[model samples]
Target chain A: MTADTTRRQLLAGGAALGWFCINGSWLQSTPAQAQADGFAPQHLSVAQCSAMNVIADALVPGAHVAGIAAYIDSQLSAKNDSLLLVKYLGVPTTAQSGFYRPALDSCIRLLAADGMTPQLALTAMGEDAVSDWQGPPASFFSFVLRADALDVVYGTEQGFARLDIPYRAHITPKKPW
Target chain B: MSNALSTDTVIVGAGAAGLLLAARLAESGRRVTVLEAGPKRSTDDLISSQIWARRLKWSGPQVEELGDHKVGHAFNAGFGTGGSALHHYGVWLRLHPGDFRVASDHGVGLDWPIDYQTLQPHYDKIQSEVGLSGDADAEIWRPEGAAYPMPPMPLFAQARILQKGFEKTGRRTAPLPLAINSQPYQGRAACQFDGWCDAGCPIGALANPLVTHLPRAQKAGVQFEHNALVSRVLRDPNKAARIRGVEYFQGGERHTITAKDVIIAAFTVQSARILLSSAADTTPAPGNRFDQLGRYLTSHPAATVFGLFDEPTYPHQGVSGGQLLSHDDYDNKQQGNGFGSSQWLIAHAIKPHDLLGYGTGRPDIVGNQLEPWLQDAAQHLANMTLVVEDIAAPNNRVTLSDATDTHGIALARTEHNLDARTARLWQQRIDEGQEIMRAARAREVWHGPRVAMHIMGGTVMGKDEQQSVTDSFGRVHDTDNLYVSGPSLFPSSGAVNPTFTLSAIASRQAEHLITQQ
Candidate 1:
């Protein structure tokens, strides 16, 4: 094919190619199915994922269905290719796991105590009232988690539609996150 | 070590400025070679996904940042061929006439060695060449320049709603001058208003260096070396007056290249990093004779105000840079309790994710309330960003980091703190922004944190060698052959986007270089 023809094809096939590339091994197991069937996170532990899910669901309802834990895990696993907004805020790619791991661990420990609801836990985080919390900062961690929750819950076309907004895409995404 | 190569001109950082200069110089029959620290990218790589677009951002050596207002280096800079312009929102605005004489007019901030009149011809030339779309006459705050080649982009529902707010507040607004094509121009397709500009414009609708300058440079026979991180500029051992070439790392090996002239166009921090790292045992870095190599770093303090209007306004129907602009408060540098200029970019096309995303804006609305709040905002949200000019404090600077990268080169360490007056100006504008939002009959209004945007200075241009690193023509004050291009040469932060001004400076520099040769 001519260069012009190839360029046109690439432009037309951009979304499809991106979808396949991102899905890679997860194509067979949709985000919903993975969440339903107890998705195995590659980088995060079970407890870490559990805490992330609870906190994310608290920050953004339907985040569990949107696969917030899976999204964070996938992005963290990508390392340098991470789409986490924290990358734009000073935290380097090499130290990205360091930023998330300890914070999630702190969340798990904090929530493991009796009668700790996601709302109360988040409130405590906002107030820096969590005892023995071992991550960056309770308030900052909550902010970052809240941002991540938003990403998975409303960063896609279907997500936009869920909020009654039009996904007027020049090049449409093949699948929602 | 790899065998040394030679070229007529060696330009570090294949960014907007670098590519533009390379194209012009090569077209004028001078051999040019550009060394880029990141990978090579094409329009094909410019996907619509924000996650995938992260690949376009700066992923090189970490820049250690300190101070109250740390420049968002990684966020503001791009990685590959097009540099930061790859993902830029294409808000092409020229600096005002008063902006060039900040110190003289307002008795605050440094003044530009060259005035707006000196750069006006180049601005007009670049606008014609690159094709900016806007109603030039409507920009009452604009400096004198040629009329825009194309008419302004059509106002979306969000913009129309926000324009009412500006009108109600008795402030004037004009269609934001954008490098984005409003209609098919110079064979490129018109913009689709996809609002995926941060992901890079795959189509040639946005005039990024990928489509605008890189291709022209290639056509003009300018050579490019991607994944080539230039460590430092080399000087002749015998002659202290002249530069020999540059040392770089590629494919896990060190290499050297000799050139007649060297231009460091790496976006702000890294460009400063290269010069600061070049200090030898006997001699200081090329332009550090007066100990002013990495001084006078500045970044615009910016924030966004979001409001929920009763009207159904689709906020995602335009470019990310915004649909309209209000510069009514821009020229008045000495406004109440503050001493700097400020402008409002109204009704930007917003996303749900990322830093400026609408969903990310309200952290308080959570749990069961999250969905409803997001749903309301998705339709009714109208937002505007306030860009406040930062004073060029000498202490706010870029220094060499004690820590070294794997390649054994010291990383760039940036220290930037906003002046008290500048902070007051930011707060003042943000307060007025909410008032304007409420005047438009909004139910709720809130603002984002004050963060730095569009970094400038570090190797500032001035007439005095002791006060600046480069001359008005971007030539290093002390060195004859060494030049610094891009926003790093800016003497002041002018409450406007720096791309147009930087491009014009590069265009002027290209002319000077060709003439000198």
Candidate 2:
């Protein structure tokens, strides 16, 4: 077989369970037992990630456990056309980037300015960002962080469960609804 | 490339319709050449997961918009030969008979010149060729069509639970007819019933364009040139009309393909943008004098409702998005409601990776609290999405933006407004759905933040050339030798997915283009 064919086979095998469920090709697992394999990260600093995890769990409970963080991180690492190309270079490509870092720093700066702890200021900024779409809300920092986080935390898999959401998957049987 | 390699037909957008048309044309011994904006992808090059399928994502330069919602432009189009069909869930449903002639019945929304019966034969033919899996006998509510080639997929626990709830609520649900293979026909393998199809099915079981039609087209001596981003249709000064080929950007350089007949199969927004932008380049005065080119853009208002079941729903065990469909109210389009009709696509297989991306009522879950919910919800991931019908409105349109790209091409600007009538319909159906969930004994019920589903209807087809971009058979009304296809031809957005119908219409167009000549 060609290298591409071999690679395709490997991915197909690895994602066999997903393929079966998505395409109706084979029965990968029963509805009950298949929950354990939800994507998760292996190398995350569990302690550092704990705060984000806790917030995510409460927002969409089952999704956090389903490895949404891992998934988010994975998606984040991949480059796309939408990526603010300069962000990865650790340089300011857009004016928003210049404002973003300072806003985060200001959260700490405000605490320092007011004689409050740096950690406490960070927590405060996080809280303010989540509750309202107003204020500087960490200026541009809030937009990037919240947008990226929402892309993961409140996305297709985890978001649905958190809201107890469902889709109308069928149209013919005329079920109870 | 040699100029001598010109063909009788040059098709833009090597997507499902274009590929299928090319294959059929080549089989008839006609020279067919396809130009795709994205990279070429063969069956072997197809990846198994959404994460690995990054190349399929559209890489169009940034666009500017005035609304709270942009088209999510860059991410919408697929950047490969198979186009969006590569990542599509393969949900195939025909437009209801009532969908056409809406202006007569409802006194609003543009009416389609050709009725559902006209498209029915083509739908049946495409379904057979593509091998649709469903029980036509079971779909009594479905429009007239031939039987599905394969049997209905087995119901998983999530669908079963939703069915029970829907049944309890006195709602009607049917098995979702999907392009996904159930038992495998047309020499393709049967589906393994895993839920990772949004990532592009690696196995040939799911009918992605790469696996099904493009290969056949290639085998028929159809030439496919990828990464050829057509900038515009260049025309000559001759008053008669000059079909002088398409100008595109390829490999950091500009290239042109001279052809006799050109078909623009780019998806809705892009297709209209191409014409509008090209008109600006070639014919500055074209104005919306046709009064139709970029008007009446519509998309299904897609919303999701999630219910937590007590039992293990195992949402990840079945087809990506096929099982039960709620059509009890599909044909119930009231004139003033703005909302036409709606359908339910249930038990959508949700992978842990991409599920949370759809911001619904779901709050973010993080840290310690998430694990238990995952453990509990994984077994009971019974989710359903509501696809509401949106009528073509002049206000909801795809317009040209002032923002020019690096190549100096004008970007597409879109403006979408939801009428109060449509909003009321959405609220009513969602409320009803919540009641159904309660009847199903769901522990909780939540709805998705209403967002645009499938983008369509910008460049529409109609009988009157003055009011529509293309004719009934998708032939451009202005240009004699130019044709356009895809969901852009939809005069009115139906309650169901448009892929199946798009394929059917494309088939009809291809046949018309070949035979009429």
Candidate 3:
């Protein structure tokens, strides 16, 4: 696919694919496709992405398959054009990744030290009970991460259909992002 | 740098106010150019999905916000061609008569330089031009004005259910005054009641700038430059009181647009940010003689009341701004343990997700309980919002931040804390809202946390030079041919939405500017 596609062409592809930098090549892919192909993140490290996927998926059951981590990674890398929920929380474009990196690492630390299940760690994080928890308040981070998870899982036409709501489109979004 | 572009008038931001001003000025045989900070977009870009609606919000320089309220600048401000109005819910309401005399009547907040009578004509004009759907006679609290251009939007099941609660509580409800087409008006399609209004009304039913002033501006030959982030108004060094257009950055390159008159209509925060940044070494910013350029910032303290009913309400069947309005306590500012006016916007069409959604508000519900709860709420939920008036406090202001953007221009930092009375009033009204929900016979009723909605003030208009940044006409106090428009000129936030009021002010300003031309 071309690097830039018109709205018609994108919609013609039935749910457009965002241009992502995987490995060294730029390819058109969705977050789900990116996660399945093990697409390398340009901004976040592999370990960080793995850790985030675990917590985010735990927060929303289908988030892992829906590519919550990849969605966040892609949005963070998009800089000023990011569609992350954190933007609505007043997180600056330059400091968006700064919010996610330490928070995800804390989840990694919680799993390593306490050997707690993803569900348990999520409960602890939501309550701000995790010891040595880092990055934006733990509870706040959980809310934001869960919001990100929700977006990927239930913020699209298919997501709306899952709840049996009408996906009435005046102008449908070419890409989920 | 290319040679400076020249125009009779240069308006910053292509939002509602800017487009209205551009169209009015350009049609009167003047060259008007508008500079927008974000990407170019049209009705085709207004996707039905809420996720895509994020693109309509502010994407310019980072505005660091502080204090209890913090203005929620990131969420409230907008980007791109149509600006924030593209994503706004079409809840257009006029300010109450008491709103103009905040200082005289209540001894709190600044008074508007002009009274409702001065703006009454403009309000009537804009309403007639754009067509507002409402029952004028039903809104008994509405001040003397012409009837709405179109009939009110239909009350869906959700709205009818919510109205019963208000009626049971002895509060009267009327169809909401919205700048949306009830039927085809002026060649625009009527609202589809699809609940995608927050995602920009693509069908031209909602009076977004695209279907309103923008088309007029385009037809009148107004030039628009997208991705042009204006830094500050360029004041002529030789004549300190006169402006020489504006300086903006486009595609990493600084450019100048010299205009006969310069209008800063970049919403609330950025409008103040531009003027605050325009301070000269010898002279302070044009209207900052008394350090009042960015003062008196205010936002309505609002919250949503959610309830789950036994009957299917078809929660996703109406506009996002709700279907009905109640101002039963609007005239009595000091009634019911509250100091300011409060109104109810009842029965907003809803979704299962998004920031303002019921599911998102219930962060505690998770695991297997989520999907079932969402499905249940989607079919049976009803919601209404309580909007309380905001008193303009001097301390709550927008100033230049320590931070700078890529072009070395100082970013905006807003500190907005709700007045004690306003906060109390919000709590009182929200509590009342909960009771109304239950009175309507809902099994359970809950309310969301107090939030900042529809930003206003910042560069407020007043008669006194030392007390205000601009005159009643929105011209900066000490500057010639330099003005500020939009919600930034509002001196007080009435317990109603600001779009109708701001658009009226723009019309008034446009007429004044055209007369000067």
Candidate 4:
């Protein structure tokens, strides 16, 4: 068969599972479960993860447990196939890391300088009042990250049950992320 | 390109129009080949999760946008086998008779080459083929057409409660016409009211291309090449008047497919992008001699109104398109401050999260304040969307961006802006929608920011080359065997979902092609 045929087959045959690298092996797990299991992210540094978790958990409670860092990391690794809503907003997959890495540094800077809480920094970011903030407008980045947090925390079947709505899925998703 | 491919006809894009045309032409004994930019997909791939549904949206190229109103190409365009119709809410509405002559009557926008009467038979034929469900008589504003084949989908608690607002406001409500099967028909099962339409109905109930034309094309021996990103339509070197096939990138290699006929059905932006990229040094692109290839682009200016009533509305109990519709203000485009047609899709099935979710609309409720508010809105929220017609303008267009893809072809850049009249109409409808929500005894009411709904025009059809890129039959004016299909050929932006009208146009094109062949 042709190489193009093989590539098409690979893409079409993707398993409906989010495989995380945990304890030196690949395991199918939700973003939250991957976080709880100490899965190593293929992308994102430890500092970036810490900053993302703090900021996301502050935006939507339980986002840290839901693994917003792991979710964003996994999506970024997928390149053009990334399911992040930022794709709809005109951010190219190749430039996605450029968007996250720098804004995350801004958050790190704010947290380190004033001993400010994550909530305070997030409010400032939302208001576009962060001093010396960099990369994608602070408010826009907050909107995107907040959407990412909501996806991992309440965009799944289990999340629906928490809100007292029936998860009447015609084809239930295999992964939560 | 050593191993060149050849076919009697080469169809670009495996979306609704291409698949329908493929099945019809292949059945007429033509050797047809379809190239899809996205991966191969089946019903099993349609997972019922809002986050998972994002996989169905455009992932091929980044479309840079600029304007007061930008068409949400990535959100509205689709990928994979079934295309955007897979994620569509199945609101299959027909254009009104008055919608055909906006330029001739209102002195704004471009009028369609053909009137609604010429297209009505095809609309009826597509409905019969796809099995639509609606109460035709109840739709007081409906244009002339055949009655739906199946009875309307049943109303739920949310729809019943929302109808009272229309009653009190002296407005009218009708069963929303849908392409979904309300009862078992044509071997497809009935809808189960699972609220998973946008996630794609996997049970063959909703008339997605998967259940409609894809299988028929497969049965008719139409060969499909997945993950083939087409760059441009090639010109026939020996004969300048005739058109050749296409060049595409697949499997990290460039390939060429030569055919007697070529059709571009790559939705709106990409269709215009391909034509713009086809311009070789001296010979302007096919159908672009007058620089009218991507002009007159349009999108419906739409927004959603949400309210939390005291009683349980059970907002998540029906199909995503909503259970009822209001077209009381549809016939009058110049009503109040607005100068365009508008309609309301009422009582849609909703969830607690995702972009259109009520909880997400209220970004102020966060941290500990979120879950409780989400839980309350999940059961008690009532919502509806206002879709206003946009007047097509020459300035709104799709052009080639300076940025190039891996294949070195310029990417698409679109700029679409609303006319002052359309914006005013949208605001008027939004305010009226809020009033109706309050009239329904909603304790709290709010509306989402105005957003772009359906994308259309770009490579619109008209009488001649100076007016548009194609004729009424979608044939490129300068070429003998070049054509375009889908909503890209629309000359006006009617205030309704476009899938049904696009399918009808496809049906007409298929018949014309077959009879001519």
The DockQ-derived docking category for candidate 1 is: acceptable
Chain A: TM-score in each model: 0.81, 0.33, 0.88, 0.85
Scored by lDDT, the top model is: 4
Cα RMSDs of all predictions?
5.4, 9.8, 3.9, 5.8
lDDT of 1 by residue, B1-517 (tens): 9999999999999888999999999999999999999999998888676656778899999999999999999889989899999999999999989898988887876889999999999999999888999998999888888999999999999898888888998999999999999999998999998788888998889999999998889999998999999999998888875888999999999999999999999999999999888889999997889887788899999999999988888887788999999999888788878888889998898877777787777777788777777777777898999998989988989999889987999999999998999998888889999999988888999999998899999999998878889999988877879999999999998989999999999999999999998
Q: A-chain TM-score in candidate 4? A: 0.85
Indicate the worst ten consecutive residues by lDDT in candidate 1 chain B: B46-55
Clashing pairs in 4: none
* Ranking of candidates on DockQ, top first: 3, 4, 1, 2
TM-scores of all candidate predictions against the true structure = 0.95, 0.80, 0.96, 0.96
DockQ of model 2, rounded to 2 decimals: 0.08
The reply for model 2, stretches above 4 Å from the true place, is A1-177, B1-5, B44-46, B53-55, B65-71, B280-288, B335-338, B355-361
Q: Taking the tens digit of each residue's C-alpha lDDT, what string does model 3 give over B411-467?
A: 999899877777777877888889999998888888888889989988999999989
Better of 1 and 3 by TM-score: 3
Q: Every model's DockQ, to 2 decimals?
A: 0.45, 0.08, 0.61, 0.57
RMSD of 4: 5.8
In model 4, chain B matches the true chain B with a TM-score of 0.99
Q: Which scores greater on lDDT, model 1 or model 4?
A: 4
